[model samples]
Target chain A: MKVKQISVFLENKSGRLATVTRVLGDNGINIRALSIADTADFGILRLIVNDPDKAWQILKNNEFTVSETEIIAVQVPDKPGGLASILETLEKSKINIEYMYAFVGKSGENAVVVFRVEEIDRAITFLQENGIRLLTGKEVYTF
Target chain B: MWNREMETIPRPQLEKIQAERLRKTVERVYNNVPFYRRKLDAANIKPEDIQTVKDLERLPFTTKQDLRDNYPFGLFAVPREEVVRVHASSGTTGKMTVVGYTRNDIGTWSEVMARTLGCGNVTEKDIIQVAYGYGLFTGGLGAHYGAERVGAMVVPISGGNTKRQLQVMVDFNVTALACTPSYALYFTETAAEEGIDIRSLPLRVGFFGAEPWSHNMRKEIEEKMNIKAIDIYGLSEIIGPGVSSECLEQDGLHVWEDHFMVEIIDPNTGQVVPYGEKGELVFTCISKEALPLIRYRTRDISILYPDVCRCGRTHKRMNRVMGRTDDMLIIRGVNVFPSQIESVLLEIGETEPHYQLIVDREGNLDDLEIWVEVSEKIFSDEIKKMEELENKIKKEILSILGISARIKLVEPKTIARSEGKAKRVIDRRDVYTK
Candidate 1:
């Protein structure tokens, strides 16, 4: 299953991140999971939001460099080795993960981890063949 | 002096020579180049009307746009077969402003460049390292030919490779260095970092040009390297790097009036300013055969000094360039236009057209930072994709402009939006000459 993610380009200036969050918050768009990849000069803020299309629009209207990307959300057992187990499975299949971030689901027994892998279809098929549960876009948005 | 008789020719005789050469150049261009013929015809001026050097103002001024409109080989008076070499500088767009030289034209360049080196007393016994970039830019091969003509051992090291340059300087006993003034200073610092005392080396003189520098920069370089720093000036359109050069006196750059007729004109009005006034420097190639540009506006702002220098050269000297009429930035000796950067961004189709070029001097070298606004079409969640886009932009700019620049992907609306004209350049470097 493919999940929608929003990414914003942020310069390493004061209050840039705050402005991005404030723009989304004022528009009533909820950010579900977020992670920042930063360098000395600039940063890339990857976000999973409740309403990605609305969030992307509001961010674009606010003059933010935002993009919508399709990432996969996987449900893992709520334990210390949950991420390690899924990573081991992907590593065994030789699937490369570009980046990943995690968040605990509402059930409190499972965790949701967003993964951006190189080959989406192949990874999706391989993970399904290995009996891994993949959450669809709607499931992640409501969670 | 390489040619002492020509260098110190009397004013009246030199004017006579210039008038004769100018007349011949006008006749040749009129008969050979359709562009010049049409321009002269449109102005209702004939070649015979330009009988004296004073009549030069009657001719139409050729701008860089004219050269671009002609493109490659469009303005050459000689046929393509007779032209021995062609060098190009970056135009305002993607195309290059190409210049051609015949065999005799090359000889003229060599002779003038020899005189340029001779200004600093470069002789046959010296070992010279021509450190300017070689191909296309006209600095390296220009100084190379001159050093060879002076009967000196010419080490065509070109540019970059600081460690090897120092090794060759120390091993080969380099007596003279030819490069941009900034690079000469950079080399001095690099030499010290490597524990190579460049001052103790046999490096006696430096010929620096291609970009403008200050007298204070000269003093700093002279002190750092223990060498006599000389300022040489030229452009690709008008026979590079030997148009004018400062002799040992270092008072002002003595324009070689025998080959090039120099004039200071009000850039806005196209009228000649009185001598010793600040205006755009224009040149008429009096003796060139291939591309004899007549009254070509150089856009460099400077004053002309008509007094005889202490070096006894009778050619009128021009003060160091104070500024430019155009927004062309000379970054690391390469001509970079803001429009060129805009064209690059437009071609890439990834970033917004709004951008700013930040030019600053880091240490002794020029650093160019391009801040381009990231558009929605190019932004991605992956950092690797963004980095690839940055590299692509950097590579495209390098291929087009011939200079490396740091491509900074700034957020949209980060670059200030002006009301009328978007201010595209932020030059933080100190204005030392002014």
Candidate 2:
């Protein structure tokens, strides 16, 4: 299932991220998986939340600018070569991954790997055609 | 039926006057003002090229920075001995804009002042109370000289001493007043408090300028003082306040196009705006002998109206100035000027127009904040009344200005009052170089 991730734009003013996090926490929007890309002056907090649409609305109402993107969620066994195997499959499909991160499954039986890819729709189609099971957002985030 | 300029002759006649003036002025500049002659040589434009009125564009536009860079005396077209009257703008950054007027130039000034006074319906019997400051500021002398030229008895009450200002108005039976719009309101309020019979006072009209004011503000002043508030627009570089004045109809200030050529142009591109669009105002003073400025870029933003004015004077009128291009504060991609804020405050009724534009650097970007003094009687006796009034004012200011101004209702006169032109901006957004 495709889930939209909201990337909250934040500047690194001492407690800016904490203020945003506190604001989100106060609004009761649960963060599912989060990754931060930061520079000296500012940072982008990309979050997969329990209700991204609601969280985005809340942030926007507070005058925070939020943008969305689709990320690949792959299910891997709790074994060493699982990530390597997925990368090899993507290479075989000639799909180059831009950047990636791993989210340990909530129940720890497996890991949900997320990737920023050059072609997200084609990667999803190629994986489905190759019988590679993509993790359901519910299974990866709430299992 | 009311389409001709009573003062203006035919086009060829006007061109002949301009060419003769331009030739004499160019010769004067080439001989006396080395900087201007140098600039002309650099541009490969000789003094002979400026023989026609159409060649005005060939000359370069002078800027505020040019005045600052030259510091002083670098732009005088005539010798120092020939300069009879001198004035300068109160430059906050460096030096000051030094302007000179020869005896003939002063005559032109007085003549223009007479024309401006003609707009106000002043007769030789009228008592002119010139309340604007008399220093280097062009307001007082502009009105004073005009009153003198019109053969009216002059009371040169050069600004301040509001108590005496009222006293003379009542004592001398002053028929007309001239000052900045804000200070005029201050006088009205003071006159009201003292229970001085305003109706008994002979203030039939007021010539308000040096800062932008709105129709609502003018109406308020008119209603309070029982006088019509006519706008007289000018700057130090362009021979001051007599440059334009609103006729009795209050249509717009009619520019005295005979001695001066007025053009509105793109502030950045210097491209001339068509007759009806708003742009930066540029003035070419063709007649002044001491320092005739060729296309001096007055940073004030305005639009030219070539429409036939109801007044018999066919001189092209400029819409009451909206704001200054230089005074504009670009905040978060929004262009906000203090004049716009003042108009917003005035339109809403019962809001004091004391405002300071405060801009600061927040994080890596610029943050804008505005501090406005609350009107004397905001409904703030109860808690709910205070909050409600604040919200109302905030919403109104926001609706007109586009950017949300953090409205702070400081006590009256809390803004360091300037007897002359009020300082509108306090920008502190220096780029942090780390």
Candidate 3:
């Protein structure tokens, strides 16, 4: 139930984000879901890609500081209280979410939310016991 | 005219006094300090052989590494009881170059500092404000004692507290100021912001040292504060800020040859350079009682002129220090080395070993910004984690170096990889120009 995410360290300068996307696109690596965490001086570009290992290698070879992280993609109902209910479940179990971002899936009835939690295995087990669907690495990469 | 007899002693008479003092210091160190004893024995030289100041070259040169090897209290000629004070400055590593002073040694320091203030003709009627930081660094108490010895009312206001400094300067009618040249410039700006015209004040002279500054900076400070700026020079390894000072003429700083014997030598060849030529400065503390150094290499580059100054002081005058032979950087009167910063990063084990130190002057104070390349091993998807890494590096550097530096995390290949000696320091302060 773990998905590999590619995170690139981006300096707060013009065209850096564009350069990262261009590098991945030219190498045929499709970015499925992405979010940027920014500050006044720098930003972190977190990405879920079709081929994470390939994207990581390409970014590293291109002189960008990149790393691989493990996150979970959960299929939540496409409704207002969908994320709130999952968050409430995790909060009851005391599993801390470091960061989270959402993306609309091809199936209009559901949405995929990427969560980076502190206790990955415990979070996966607790969420599964609560009858929530967790997308595997292969399923998320292919989708 | 503090100690006018020694300051104006004839060249021949000064040389005789130096020879006599040199002989005594060599004998004292050889007998008391085991480190110097081993050094002298390894060189196959005896105390009796060093008859005059010219024989100083026969002795082995003492480097900062030697000081570190001895650690604390290893180089003092006097016993622990006789040593009354100790002052230390940061070394290139975690260890510090420690120095001790005896009662007589403190008296000697006061005498030289008095001469330093006397260069500006500071008298008892003048109220001197000693702005140099007063702890182990020696600038504070060194100037304080000298001003008191001159019978001047001393305001022992240590460094920092800018507004308080200005208030004391005005309320006390300070006539002389002693501090770093950069701080003097900073005071001018602060005075203007507070709408206090410093030119209209009674502040007349400033003794600036503990860092290398340019002639242009002197002109700027003099113009801004309407004060005669004099350059003073010294190190904790020697007797703090009293080794030499520029007279009112402002031509060159006069080295007190009667107390400290000065020499200029080719840094690579170790051969004595001709007079008026630039070389590494080396001093042998001839009159010091506690921490007597024999041919201690200062690593500062400058020239020595035997010509007597027009100020009637026969002591040999040396030009302002041009640069250092090593990569040590002085930021706001504190010693900083690139290797020290490297050691700090290595200990943290968070960032890559590749880094660069950028020293720049912002509004009359030195600012150090460190550019460290982020490594993939420590990079995180969470921005807070990355910020924590930067803060950890900054805190470690501050704890080790005693100065706060802005840690800038850049991309992996942002710092250029060099095949030769890596360029580690980028000094944009422009304070070292002649």
RMSD in order of candidates? 2.7, 18.1, 1.3
Q: Native contacts retained by model 3, as a fraction?
A: 0.80
lDDT of each: 0.91, 0.74, 0.91
**Which whole-number lDDT from 0 to 100 does residue B349 have in model 1?**
81
Task: Order the numbered candidates by lDDT, best leading.
Answer: 1, 3, 2
Please state the error at residue B419 of candidate 2 in Å: 36
Q: Please write out the lDDT profile of model 2 over residues B1-434, one tens digit for every residue.
A: 11135354555676687778777777777777777888888889888888887777778888877877777877887778988888876343324578889899888888888888878878788999888878777778888888898889999888778899999998898998888776787787788788886766878988888766667778778888888889988777879888988889898788877788888899988988798898988888878888788789987788898765775666788988776667765454233667766765676565557778787645323456666554424422223344555567678756654446666544334467678455778867431111
* Candidate 3 per-residue C-alpha lDDT over A1-143 given as tens digits, one digit per residue, 9 for 90 to 100: 89999999999999999999999999999988999998888899999999999999999899898989999999889998988998888899898899999998777788899999999999999999998899998888877
| Reference-based TM-score, model 2 | 0.58
Better of 1 and 3 by TM-score: 3
Residue ranges of candidate 3 with Cα displaced over 4 Å: B350-352
How well docked is model 2, in DockQ terms?
0.01
lDDT by residue (B1-434, candidate 1, tens digit) is: 99999999999999999989999999999999999999999999999999987899899999899999999889999988999999999888889999999999899999999999999999999999999999999999999998999999999999999899999999999999999999998998899899998889889999999998877888899998999999999988999989999999998999999999999999999999999899999999988888999899998999999988999999999998888898988999999999998988888785458789999999989999999888877777788888888898899899989889999988877787678456899887654353
- Residue range B89-134, candidate 3, lDDT tens digits: 8777777889999999999999999999999999899999999999
* Cα deviation of B255, candidate 1, in Å: 0.9
Off by over 4 Å in 1: A79-98, A117-138, B431-434
